[model samples]
Structure formats: structure tokens, C-alpha cells
Target: MLLRLPTSVSEARECLAEGAVPIGGATLLWAEWQRDGFPALAMSLRGVPEAGVLGRDALGAAVVLHRIDDRVPDVLRLAAASVGTGAVRRTATVGGNLVGSTLRCLLPAALVLEARASVLGPDGVRETDLSEVTAKRPLLLGLRWREPVASAYRKLSAAPGGRPPLTVSVALHADTAGPRRLRVAVRDGYEVIDGGAPHDGDPDTALHTLRQTALRDLPEAAWDAVAAQVAVVLRAADDV
Candidate 1:
């Protein structure tokens, strides 16, 4: 097996240009590799910087879960908390959590936060939306985004204790004059954009509409319960 460790972002990008499959944390990737013989070329991203919670929080993808808990916003914190246990978090990286996408709890939170990520490939370093990266990837060097006024993440597990979570996240953009940006990201990425707040035009109307627009496909029996839970997510943000 060919292995490369690039410490800097530029070096990481160079490795990708050569067709190396980038490995972030590899909590899952490594497992797959072990199961199906290792790949020809594997680039380890651990050498890059991926921790910090100040200013936009540089959050290098290599930073572990414990650091994520220390620096990221509440929504991200909650998502990180749900990843595994303290031991797992100590080894898990944000990029790893993100790659899990629906398999983990952080993707929805990252979307709700409208986080921005830097993907490096042969072309160059380009800034892309969080949701956009969810569908594609090359290498995630860093993630940056401003902290929201208030944000929350929720999960509906398949059972009492489960590894994968049916996750949902809500983020409120605090702007008094302009239309509110109420970002919500479900497990499969049901997103609701800008809308009036409970006070602006109608009380809970936007929230209710969000529930409808995002959860319209649910069966009649589960609709109300899901909506109620979504309401709790919205209310939780407002209560903060």
C-alpha cells in the first residue's frame, strides 16, 4: 500500500492531484479498507491543522472530536457529543464526522450552521457550501463559519441506543430588519430557507411552514409527532 502524509494544505492538494484518495480520521474509511484490501495510494490528513474555536474557528479537518467540543458552536457541539463516547471523540475528526454524512450527526448541523469548507483538488483551493460538499468531495482542509445567534440539533434514534441517528438541526440568523434566515437540515438534508419569524408577520407561522415544507412526506400518523419535535427544535433556539 502506498501511504503519504502531507502536513500543509498545499501539500495535501498536491497529493490529491496525483490521484491519491484522501483519508480524514479514517474511522470509517480505514474500516472499509481493512475489509476490502487497502487501496494503492492513501493520503493521510492528520498532519494538517484542524482545531480552534475562535474567530471563524479554523477547525482543520484533522482536529479530533474533543477539540470540536471545545471550539465549535452549540449545534456542532451537540452533534459532536452524539458521535460516540469520550474515547471515540478523542480520536474522531470533524472531517470524519462530516464524511459520515447521513451516517453521523454532524452533517445536518454543519448545514444548519451554513458552514463553509475549503476543498483542495488539482484545480486549486475553492470555497464551497457545506451542503454542496456533502454530495461530493476531494479533500476537506478546513471549515469556517460565523457563530449563529442560537442553534440546536436533535436526533430520533431507531432504538433506545443506536449508532446512527435520525438527526435534525435548526439555526437562526439574527437579523432584525431583513427577512429571517431560518436554516433547518434534516438527516437526509431537508432544508428550509429565509422566512419570517414568529414575531415579524405571524407567530410560529414560519416555523409551522418550515415543518410542512421539510416534513411533508411523513405518514399521517408520524406527521404530528415529527412536527412537534421540530417545534421543540425551533423553540429550543428561541428559548436560548
Candidate 2:
């Protein structure tokens, strides 16, 4: 397999233009490579400083999960901390979590935050909504968003730690002249974005919707536990 290490955003874009698949952390990508073999061309973003920044309201694609702390938004920090073991977290990247198929670790928070992605694609670089990245699966450079008034994250899993079967996240955006906007997202497989809150913004109804949708495949008993977690997180977020 041919590998290209790009030291800058522009260089990384050039690699993409040449059909190199972007890689970071390689925590998930390595697994895919082991099973399916390497891509013809691959670009590692680790050397690119532009892809590794963690700012007040923005996060570079290559920022490692372990680097996310109290400095970032609460919801994002919580999700990042929940991703994997200490070792795995140290190796996983924000971009990898955003683009990965098996475990979209940071997706719930990103969606609820209404984060915009800086993508470099065929049409050249552009900033677009996070939802668009979900649909188009573009090469992400980083993410940016307006700070929300409050945010929360919750998840239920059989294991005490590591990956979870389902996760729910909500972010409250306050408006001075209007009612506060609530963005809720549930992630299991394909995420369900309930742009508005559930039952005119009831957290319980949101969990019910989660039960009916994302958690439907799990055993019936598991629903109650998941609901409890969602409730706790929602209430905590409300207090924020």
C-alpha cells in the first residue's frame, strides 16, 4: 500500500485530489485494512498541524480524543471520554470518529451542536452543515459551531466502559428574542435528528422515540435502562 503524509491542509487536499483516502489515529481504519486490505493510496493527517487544533468553538479533524477535556463543550467532552479505553482514546481522532461506520463516537454531540464541517472535496474546500457530512461523507478538515447554552450526553451499554450500543445527546441554543431551540440526536446506527425536541420538548418522550427507533433491535428489558440514562442526562443538562 502507498502512503502519503501531508504536513499541511493544502497538501492534504492535494493528496485527496489524487485519490488518497484520509487516515488519522487509524484505530478504526487499521481494523478495516486488516479485514479488507489497504486502499491503493492513503494519506495520514497526523503531520498536518491544521487538522489537529482544538479551539474554544472549533475542533480540528485530527485532534485526539484524549486531548478533549473541560476546555471543549460539555456534551462533546463527555462523548469523547466515553469512546474507548484510555489507550484507544489516546489513538482515536475526531475525524475518524466522525467518518467511521461501526462506531460514530462523536456524532451525537456534533449533530446536536449543529457543528459545521470544513470539507475538502471535488469542488474544493467549503464549510457545510454537519448533517451534510453525514449524507455526503466528505473529507473533513475540522468542525466549528456556535456555543450552545446547555448540552448533555447519555449512553447505555452492557459493558461498564468502551463502546456503547446507543447514545443520546441534546444541546439547547438560547435566543434572546425567541424561545430556546433544542436539538436532540440519537445514535445507534443511522442517527435520528429530531430538530425540535420530543413532545414539545419533553425529555421522556424523546427517550420513548429512542426506544421505538434506535433501541428497537435490542432486548425489551434494555430499553428501561437506556431510558433511565437518558432521563438523568437530560435533567442534568437542563440544570446547566
- For all predicted structures, in order, the TM-scores are 0.78, 0.78
Per-residue lDDT tens digits of candidate 2, residues 29-122?
Answer: 7877999988999988878876777876889898999999877788899999998799999988898888765567788788878888998777
**Candidate 2 collision pairs:** none
Query: Which runs in model 1 stand beyond 4 Å of their true positions?
Result: 50-58, 100-102, 160-164, 188-203, 219-240
Q: Model 1 compared with the native: what TM-score?
A: 0.78
Task: Please report, in order, the local distance difference test score of every candidate based on alpha carbons.
Answer: 0.64, 0.75
Tens-place lDDT digits, model 1, residues 14-110: 8887788876566677678889888888787887654222333456766777766545667777777887678878877777777553464567677
Against the true structure, candidate 2 has what lDDT?
0.75
Using lDDT as the measure, the top candidate is 2
Per-prediction tally of clashes = 1, 0
